[model samples]
Target: MVAVGEILLNALFQVLFDRLASPDLFSFVRQLGGGVDSELKKWEKKLRMIQAVLRDAEEKQLTDEAVKMWLDDL
Candidate 1:
């Protein structure tokens, strides 16, 4: 029951996170001329990978106590 709630919350948070780093937002950031957009693109790639891992982990967490603990620490 608790894990279901936690997963739901995490899914919601993931939606917010995915939006914040969207390509359109990054394009806008690039137009602003910070030169940081390139780095942000790099980060977006890494973050995308992390997101994928997290999604898998979140699913795994229901059956793995250690996975749940790891996510809680994050």
Candidate 2:
């Protein structure tokens, strides 16, 4: 009974997670070498935080205008 929007969001989340762990991305980041690794780590941390917030917002957006707006802004 999931809505299409929810399905698309889940798919997007999976794609993001996949890209984050991708070996090609890791190899390229390593090649970049001048603090790129650190930058990637920082982004990984931020993405995790965002993912958590996204899940919370997904559940809240149904009834909360502010949350819906926040999710939409994403």
Most lDDT-accurate candidate: 2
**Residue 31 lDDT in model 2?**
92
- Please provide TM-scores, in order, for all candidate models, with all chains considered together: 0.57, 0.65
Q: How big is the RMSD of model 2?
A: 2.8
Per TM-score, the best of the predicted structures is 2
Q: Model 2, stretches more than 4 Å misplaced?
A: 61-74
Cα RMSD, model 1: 3.2
RMSD of each: 3.2, 2.8
- What range of 10 consecutive residues in model 1 has the weakest lDDT sum? 1-10
Badly placed stretches (over 4 Å) of model 1 are 1-24
lDDT of 2 by residue, 1-74 (tens): 33567668778877887898899999999998999889888888888787788787788888898977766666
Q: Count the backbone clashes (under 3 Å) in each candidate.
A: 0, 0
